[model samples]
Target: MSIREKIVKEYEFLKPEMIKTIGELITFPSVLDEEAVETPFGKNIDLCLDKALEKCKELGFKVFKDSKGYYGYAEIGTGEEMIAVLGHLDVVPAGDIAKWESDPFKMEQRDGKLYGRGTQDDKGPTVIALYAIKSIMNIGLKLNKRVRVIFGTDEENLWRCINRYMELEEKPSMGFTPDSKFPMIYAEKGLLQFNAIGKGESVVLSGGGAYNAVPDKFQYKSKDLKSLEEKLIANGTKYEIDGDTITVFGKSVHAAVGEEGINAIKMLMLALKETGVATPSLDFISDYVGNDPYAEKIFGVLEDEASGKLKFNLGKVEINSEKSLLGIDIRIPVTISKEEIVTKIKNIIKQYGFEYEERDFLRSLYVPLDHTLIKTLRKVYEEETEFDSTPLSSGGATYARSMENCVAFGAVFPDGKKTEHQPNENLAIRDMDRAFIIYAKAIYELAK
Candidate 1:
């Protein structure tokens, strides 16, 4: 039988197993955290590792858990050649369940789609890849290589899971991550997170967290909020008033793709200018919040890169007797230098005599399109689906960059909508079965 036929047949046998695995992963709220809290980031990660280890052992693949709790594998063959498949189980925090069609944690299947948080961003594709390995093994295919799938538990946070795994494992020859879109991805933009504080009148606000994530809610208090509202309206800005509490409506989006939407910080700045708190110029706040000269000279730059508009969120606000701290959050392009960006921001603050400090800085990551693994996967995508999709770039981050020779492959299709990190996230059931066959073929090709 043709490889495609064999793959489709194998996927039919693998459907039940795939569904059960995804359901279990979504049940755990594995968002990232630094502090060792009871339900901290990887609270149920060990449990996931246990499940993966059990299955890997059953599939005739040797499993290894690192000292730091990350897991690895050894799917043995000959010639000292190796192939890697990367995937993550940890998911982003589910926000505003009221916006969801169903529980974000519970896996729901409707109209050929499975709805849940990790169902698309990663867990779905990850399971498909594992079963791909199983299908290849079940067929007793002999090849000249070994394929190993690595499950990371902290990809949404610091990527410590894969970092720890590398400390105990050898790098693979080539690999693909089944987490992104199809046709394939050839380039991925870098990411950076920064904070800026100024010494204007202070406001009282709190409850924003995760620099890479959009804050669910935040509120600020200013003695002159009435004037603030007037200034905002005068400046062609938008906002909401609640008694003495001024709530600026900041658009929320995943940090990787934040540039595509309106930022909360800019709205607050406009509101401040309308109220005579700061200059209406983007530079006024950009100087305080951005890292380098880019903010100072961004007015013209906005026209060129406006397709990927940069943005910030006014996650939290607070006013006090000392000074109001505008908890401004920012996401910028990857090509910018971190120190230069910070220096420009510091310089802007010095001019206003406002003190500013950065709270978190996450580096951006990217890989080239000509990469062998990327080429191989792209070829597979074209051959299998007859779709000539090229490897594309994205603002979102993934565990693919955590290791070498890895590019994100698909559970998400191009015509497919982006529900990742958004409410009512889901994966089409037909897409799930199709992904299994694709993954199985990719694994067979990589393993051989």
Candidate 2:
């Protein structure tokens, strides 16, 4: 049989084992713990990293671990140039355990889907990449370059894992990360996280998780909510009134697509303003931001053709007797400068007595469509799926930005649903089976 045919047959035989292996990795609640300073990211992440490295070793690939417990890699083949396949073992926290159909740490198979936290994000894709490498070996494919699968431990928060990889490890000649959707992501937008700090003295309220996700729930405990119940219902906000506690409910999604989410923080702020219980922060959203996730009132739908519109996410909010602090996440277009975006924000918020404190920024990434890396991956993708499409751009950040000539390849297909950073996160079984074939063929093409 041809190498492609052999890969298909091998993956079919190994699909059952693949499901079992993914379950093992998901059992770890690998959320980042700031208190665990002795280890990188956290202890749970460390254990997860160790478990991934152990699996790589079991696959008979030469493995290496960072002395500082930051990153690990599994390699196969012998050559001067190396191709990196990036995946992260860490996942976002499962927001609201009640939202999940099962334990977010336990993988479940139903209706051709695997329900778990990291299934669609990186862990499942990581396993698919591993099996792809193994399948190529089983088919006796020749490699002109070494292929390395690098496992990162902190992708949900700061990318310290991949950042350290760049500092301490040998750079790959070219690579692809399976953290994004197919066919190919040639350009990604710049990311900015900052807090809009202003004065406030009112009822206390707070909500949200990371700077990169649209918070699903925001709770405010105050007798003022009783007066606001009618306004909240009139405004069409999803919420629950429990005695003195008012909880606003919204759909959680990645900040890159913040427009799709109903920000509970936004809903709560507006409701406060409507109920005559406005703070400086609530009035800010009510007057300036409103319900527009694109922040058209502030920036006039700031966008460019290369990376689309700037995405705005009110990731976190706090209102207390002292001050109002709002944590905001913005995905700026590839052609836009950080200063331009920040200046625009300052111009708007400063009038409301708020100062923008810069938190974290990831520079935008763009690779020309004609580049060989894009061409090779694009050719293989079209061949395998019989679907032809142009290279896509994204607001989402990936490891592709960490290296030269590297772009994010697929774990999610074009038609597949995105469950990353959300509760009951899942990956379709059939899509993963297709990814197995895609990664195997692409790896062989890139390395050979």
TM-score for every candidate vs. truth? 0.74, 0.72
Candidate 2 lDDT over residue span 270-360, tens digit each: 8878888756677778777898988888887688877999889999877677888899999988878889889999988998889999999
Tens-digit lDDT string for candidate 1 (263-331):
555566545544544331233554444422233353224211311434444445444445555454454
Clashes of each: 19, 0
lDDT of each: 0.65, 0.87
Give candidate 1's error at residue 239 in angstroms.
Answer: 5.1
RMSD to true structure for each model, in Å: 5.3, 5.6
Off by over 4 Å in 2: 94-110, 195-303, 310-330, 339-356, 421-424
Least lDDT summed over 10 consecutive residues: which range in candidate 1? 298-307
